[model samples]
Target: MAANFSNSLVRWIDHRLPVFSYLRHAAYDYPTPKNLNYWWNFGSLAGISLAIMIVSGIALAMNYTPHVNHAFDSVERIMRDVNYGWLIRYIHMNGASFFFIVVYIHIFRGVYFGSYKSPRELLWILGVIILLLMMATAFMGYVLPWGQMSFWGATVITNLFSAVPLIGESLVTWLWGGFSIDNPTLNRFFVLHYLFPFIIVSIVLLHIVALHRFGSNNPLGIDIKYPNDTIPFHPYYTIKDAYGLGVFLILFAGVVFFAPNFFGEPDNYIPSNPLSTPLHIVPEWYFLPFYAILRSIPDKLGGVISMFGSIVVLLLLPWLDRSPVRSGHFRGVFKIFFGILLIDIVALGYLGGKPSRGMYVIFSRLATAYYFAYFLVILPVLSKFDSSRLLPKSISTPMPEVNGIE
Candidate 1:
């Protein structure tokens, strides 16, 4: 029986794809430096999280129907009646949060390791594209509940098309498919919500392929040139990556099981009514920083441009940092400037959650300008001449762990 099975497998391979071509590629794969740590695991972890979302989302759609009149109640039924309904809903919801958490860490890892420079620029750019698609998917998912925030949030966001100079009003009307946010808007969002994630998955797979082609960056921000500094990709780093995955999953499970709604808006529970509007309409927590940037300027068009400019600036980052070095690690002036950038983002998020006027507005404009200045002005200027303490090449000891990261 074993002989027969082996013979059949050989025959199948011989009959189908050319066997030698596949085997050679598999066995003698390109060399990957084994020195990579948990930071490298994020690409794999992010891939896993995205898979979970797609699977759970498909399960939900089997039960969910898309109609303005029925959409909200359909979800309520799923939560109340469907088997493992609550579990699936919680997983899908929390999965989005997990996705963002992993991606942000992935991006920061890139920044620290200088993964965004040179040949990997396309990889980083594709990652940003994936991030945008994820945001679009999440935003449309928010609208499906047909809640108070969902209705107004859709209305406000889609209306931004009106900020366009020549065709603004027509664009808004075209988006609405009527005078206001109605059944048409809900229907379109449902179609898009289902579609965008699949695109994100494709982009993510390409991201990994692109990353693997160039290998990965290290904490030292230097490619391994000597045998002493390198290791294999299999055993050494795989174990470390698994450990990180386990810890991240524990936190994810805790949120889904204990505090599923903690990241959500309370106003979303109320049903949407066109005539009655919520006192405050805001986007999700993740989008708050950009939202703050949007409302900072009084002019609608100007605010829209500024809001978009925040993300557009990220594309220029590879070129903007003129330093031969990749990280702020050794750069004295850059470290202080880096901290200010983080604080600036937090300030914007805070202001985004506040009402649209007064001190929040004043503070927002200043932060927005500072945001551009850091990327456009400070980074290039400081990279060239800043003097810093540098450990000698002989200083080869492993660095001390900071907050569990090596």
Candidate 2:
């Protein structure tokens, strides 16, 4: 049969390089929780999205001119002149958004299921590092377009460093590579933008290694108790992941082909002008919540610190949440607070996109407070006082049908 033939070939290749054995062990025979659901698919989805970005990026780079003088025109040229360059460019542009979409879902699933606790803390930390790296890479990539928003965005974000007591101005100057965001800034961003994706790949590999070491956290949040509680990664989870990938790709393609500019700013189409500024400057949607937090504070230095602290708080999440139970499904109060936190974040994101004045500013401040309070106060307090429902004795226990699927 084909299976036997493939196994024989794998054995032969394994004798030479061991690549087949490693693949077989890692991808085929690896034990995965039998209870894993669609939420588990986002990790693989993120990986696929990264691959799409890297490939599309390389194609776009082949036609991209990094100089500020020609960068905008060069992008236009790619759209009009290069063979299928429009498709390549659109995929790269939207892939960045899709990548974040997948990663955010992955991270939320982790939090909802308490994937960060205990032995998986390091795994969660690695994912946070990957998120930071992806943000840096995406920011630099944005600046490479040499458009009004790209140039001004770089200037504004870099200027945040000037909030430092004595070194602020000097740090911004150093980052600009001159007096302002000119050719040097564009060139450096181009180089780093290309380089960072590979660095992300390296970190992703480390993330996988760490994940495999700890195994995956299932929705049940309980350790596997019997052989029936786990299944081989090959036929079971692989098929589930493949189905998820198909659905993701259909959505991704719809955006890339039909609404490529949905996530892009209209101001970014204009060439960079030192004298003119857009009426409203906003980053990509993924960064809006943090941006709202940054602008909520009146003090420049305090705003910058608080903005960064928003993300840094996630690094301590494993310890911040001291609950013995993992899944929010079993914890009624924590689940409600988690839903509120999600709404607060969406509000922050909306406020971030709006002008920082009047009621928006007030809401931003309130939402920012809740954002921090959720992690700092709510979670820790809930850990001590909130009662959780009894959990299934084992992951293998069959449950009543819910959501029409079970």
Off by over 4 Å in 2: 1-13, 386-389, 398-406
lDDT of 2 at 401: 41
Please give the CA lDDT of all the candidate structures. Answer: 0.79, 0.89
Root-mean-square deviation of every model: 4.6, 3.2
- Give per-model TM-scores: 0.89, 0.95
Q: By TM-score, how accurate is candidate 2?
A: 0.95
Which ranges of candidate 1 are over 4 A from the true structure? 1-30, 34-37, 386-406
lDDT of 1 by residue, 12-36 (tens): 6655655643343323343455556
| Residue 196 lDDT (model 1) | 94
Q: What TM-score would you give candidate 1 relative to the actual structure?
A: 0.89
